[model samples]
Each structure stands twice: as structure tokens, then as C-alpha cells.
Target: MGIVRIGQTEITYDLRRSSTASERRITVTPGHVEVVALTSDDEAEIDAFLTRKRQWLFNALRELETTTAKRAVVLRFMTGSKIPYRGRMARLTVHRHGGPHIEISYRNGFLVDLPSWVGEEDQDAVVSSEIKLWLKRRVRRDVLEIASSYGRRFGLKPRSIRVADMKTGWGACGPAGSILINWTLVFAPKAVLEYVVVHELAHLSVRSHGPDFWMYMAKLMPDFARSKGWLDQNQGSMNADLFTSTRPIIDAT
Candidate 1:
């Protein structure tokens, strides 16, 4: 690991050599930063590349820190803890019942009932699992319907729409017309979620994010830029993975 100073912020990042990398790239996750460069590159060359992008690194680090702070409340998985659901905060209530199965339900809040035999250390994991399952069901019941309505309005029909835990992005559209949307989006406002659906559907008509694509998106959703900006600012707080170990179920390809 190496430390780089970007303005007033000091970033500690790990450097990884990738044989297939043609150019250096920087990735910022929830915790730290990563620099990926060609295996043949030396330390000095990497440092020079980082120096050139100091401003960008500094801004990203600030945004990440702000996002993490906003999400700290939901990260704790205990009774009375709050989690986001449909743009609102839902309180969690854990109950121990005499059964081998764990049951979860949601209304204004989440009710989790686990087997009495389950240890305290394991309850958090069980709660996360149950919440994920509930989110998946909501995706099937609600998000798909919303996506279809937008698709119809845009005269675009995707071959399939699947919900999964997309870590790096909100949604993706394949050449074959398959659309994969992140299930975590359930926590976002309805307008933001619609923006992502429309964005992916627009991809069906234009593969590249060129001027023509923006034109199409503007015609479909005039205020799309606002929704995109909202996602950029609040996405960190909406990350369900911060509380669980579930991976995205669909392949983007």
C-alpha cells in the first residue's frame, strides 16, 4: 500500500499489476482506493499517473466519506435499527420464536423472527438474508411493473428484466435487449429508480453514450440529469451490501 496526498486528504491505496491492463485506472470502494496498472509499469510511473489525477481522487474520497457517514445508521444490524425501504426509514424488530425456520415480514417496519437456537452472533446474518429475500420479492412484484410501463412509453421492449445486487452500477443493458437492474434501488425514491430504468432502455436504441443517446434520453425523460445527480450523491447510502454478503445474481452480458 502507498499513501498519496490529494489536497488536504491523504489516500492510502493498494497497487495491483494487471497483465492485461493497457492503461492505469483508479477504483474507489466504500473503504479504500485501488490502483490497477500494467505489470511492466514501475513505481515512479504509477506515482506520476496518480499525481495527474489528484483532484479527481480528492473529490471522490470526499464524496465517499460523506456517503458512508449518511449510511452509518443503517449499517448496524440490531433491534430498533432503521433501514431504508421505498424511500422511507423502516425500523427493525427482532423476535425469537420456537421454530427451526426464520420468518420475516414487512409493513411499516420489518419483523424478523428467528429460531431460538440461533446464536446472537448469527442473528445479524440471518436478518440480512431475510431482508434481501424480501427485497427480491419486491423487485419482482413492483420494479418490473414500473420498468415495463416505461419501456412501453419509449417503444422499447427488452427480452428480459432481472434484479440483482449490482455493485459498480445501477443498471445495464445488453445488446440482446436484456436489462439487469440493481435490487438495492428499492431504497431510492421512485423517480430515481425510473431514471435508471429509462437510461437502460435508451441503451437498447443506442449502444454508445454519445450525443445521440443523450438526445434520446432527454426526449424520454426531460429531467433525467437531476435523477442521475441524485443517484451520484445518495447511492452510497442505498448500498444494501454494506449490511450483507449477497452478490449480484445476474451477469451483465
Candidate 2:
């Protein structure tokens, strides 16, 4: 780790020199900067390389800091914590009773009853797991119903529709007309969830996302853009990570 002044800004960077690295690169994250250079390159060379990338690093760091700050709405699974479902926020109410099963009922948000044996220390994990399962099951049923309804009308039937715990993408259509959707979409608004289902179903007809494909989307759902925009704007809060980490960047040449 070293401190170097890049123009008007003072920058702190963790520099690692690798013999196998073919070229130099810099990574910018919310916390700090990381620079990778050649093992044979001297301090001057590294400094020059960093100087060339000074502006990009500053811009990337500023943008990432702002985004991380705005999206750090990590709400743990606890009573009174507002959780999103079907495009609305629900309040969680929890209770412990004499039973082995985890009972859940949704009046406005959610009401839960856990076994008396469970202690306070285990409440968060237990609640998170049970609610996630409940949401996944509901999402699966809805996905199947929507897929079936759309399939009947569009004449495009999928061999299988599965809900998966995917982290990156929302949904995908594989060979043999199989559609896999991320289970996390259960937290999205119901209309947004339907948009994802119909989107994949359309893929059974059109392979790539060309004009004809969008034409199909428009015919199926006239106002899909609103849902898509909602997902786009709130994708950062889809996960409940409390702290920022350095994600891998596209290596700069």
C-alpha cells in the first residue's frame, strides 16, 4: 500500500507486482484503488502508468462511492423491518410458540410463529431461511401459472420451468425449451415478476433480442417497460450485503 498524489486528489492504492502479468492495470472500488504492474517495472514506471489512469480512477471511485452509499439499504430479517414483496413493502411480525414447525401467515405483511426451542440468537437466520423458502414456493406457483397461460396463447411451451437461486441474471432459456428464473424475483413487484416470466417465454420463439423479439414482447405486455425500469433502478438493493467489496473489473490495457 502506498500514497500517491494524482493531480489535486491524494490517492491511496494497494499495488501488487506480478511477473506473469502481461500488462498493467488498475482497479477502483468504493473503498480504495488497486494497481497491478509488472515485477520488473520500477517505481517510476508504475507511477507513470497510474498517472495515465488518474482521471478514470477518480471518476470510477466517485461513482462507486455514491452508488454504494445510496444502495446500502440492508435490512436484516427482523420484526418491523420492511421487506418488499409483489412490488410493495410488508412489515414483519414474529412470535415464538410451543410447536416444532415454523408457521407463517400474511395479513398485510407477514406473521410468523417459531418453535419455543429456538433462541433469540437464532432468530435472524431461522426467519430468513423460512421466509425465503415460503417466498420461493409462492414464486414457483405464480411462475408456472403465468408460463402456462402465456404458453397456451403464444403456442410456445417450455419443457420445464424451474426457480433457481441465481445471483447474477434474472432468467434464462436453455435448450429443449427449459426456462430458469432467479428465486430472488419473488421480492419484486408481482407485475415485474410477470414481465420476467413472459420475457423468457418469448425466448422460446425468438432466440436473440432483436426487433422481432421486442415486437413479441409489446404484443404480449404493452407496458412491460415500467416493470423493467423498476427492476433496473432497484437492482442494487436486491441483495442485503451490508458492506462494500471490490468486485473484479474488466482489465484495462
Candidate 3:
């Protein structure tokens, strides 16, 4: 129902108002700080768990606070702040009510003059939606073209293509011909994104991320190391930016 202090730890929870389940489950996430009840009947067990996890809860809260601060910084960058494009960080130009358009173009060797029709507060949503639409169209087209080329080259064919906002991985292919591409991959560089497509498509033949996977990926992309570096350097920001969804951009795909 509220925060209670056990020794030096402070735990916050909400009492049931219209709960339907009877199990108690605690989740610690950067976007939220609370103990949730899966079932109301397990309140006692929850209390016990809180007692045992008091130190862990406190540490988790501290870590969550840090994560929140980092996300705030990223949101600030996404919202009307200058950010790097390719290798250069450019100032964002916000323009509202021109024609409902968003574009990134170069001026004076800088990426400048984004459509200001969207407000500063709606930048993340606007950018994400635009990029997502862009990605869907681009990814589908590229995946089809790439897969077709590779299918012919390697004698393999992918059954289907799908996009998801996966948190832990860029792309994966299941043995059953299912392929999941992370939506955030759209924010990455063209080369890096292509590498991901090639990587996943390669899995159509070799489902495991082993020597064979590397061998195949290397065959497809000899310079994949650069793409991996791009992902490692930029994934945190990309993942952080994906969750701040408030508005929808027209799907370009």
C-alpha cells in the first residue's frame, strides 16, 4: 500500500483495490519501483520475501535510480538536443505546423533542419515513429533483397520476416523458420543494420551461434567487426530511447 522501512531498507507497495489474482510477485525495473501482487492471498509470503531481500531491494532501487538518470539524459538528447549522426552530433531544429513532415538533411557538413512540426516534448515519439516506419519499409525491402541474393548464393531461403522491440538481442532465427529482428536496429548505421540482416538470414541454415555461424556471417560480411562495434557503442542509447513511446509516426513501410 505504501513504503515501509525494515531496518535501513524502504519498500513500497500498493494495496489491492481491484486485484484478481492470489500470488505475490516482485519486479524491479528501471521504469517502475514497486512490489506487485500476482495473487492477493500470498501477501504474507511477499512480506517474508521482502524481508529476505531487503538489502537486494535497496541496491536494486539505487541501481534503478542510476538507470533512470541515464534514461533522462538520453531523453533529453532525443528531445530537442543535438545528437550524433554517423560521426557528427548536430543540433536539432524543431519546427511545428509546417506540413507534418520530418527529415534529416545535411547543411554545412552538419545534419540539420529536422521538421519542426512536432513539439520538443514529442521528439522521441516522433523520431521513433518516423524511424520505425522508415525501418519497416527499409528492412522489409532490404531483407527481401538481401535474403533473395543470399538465398541464391547459399542455397537457403527464409520463411518469413518479423520485427520486434527485443531488449536483449538484435536478431534471432528459430529452427522453425521464424525470424525476429529488433525494431531498434533501425536506428543503427546502414552497414550495421545490413550485417544484422545477413547474420539472421545466415541462421536459416545454421541455427546456432557457433563456429559455423561465425563462418557464415564472415562469408557474408567480412567487415562485420565494425558493425558489432557500432552496436556495442550505441545499443544503450537505442534501447533507452525505444521505451519512451508517447506518439505514433506514420509507418513509412
Worst 10 residues of 2 by lDDT: 240-249
TM-score of 3: 0.52
lDDT of 1 by residue, 119-149 (tens): 8646667788778788778866676887778
lDDT of each: 0.78, 0.79, 0.60
- Alpha-carbon error at 91 in model 3, in Å? 4.7
Model 3: residue 224 alpha-carbon error in angstroms: 2.0
* lDDT (C-alpha) at residue 158 in model 2: 91
lDDT of 3 at 101: 57
Give the backbone clash total of model 3.
11
> Hey, what RMSD does candidate 3 come out at?
13.6
Clashes counted in candidate 1 amount to: 0
Q: Considering every candidate listed, which one attains the maximal TM-score?
A: 2
- lDDT top scorer: 2
Residue 164, model 2, lDDT: 83
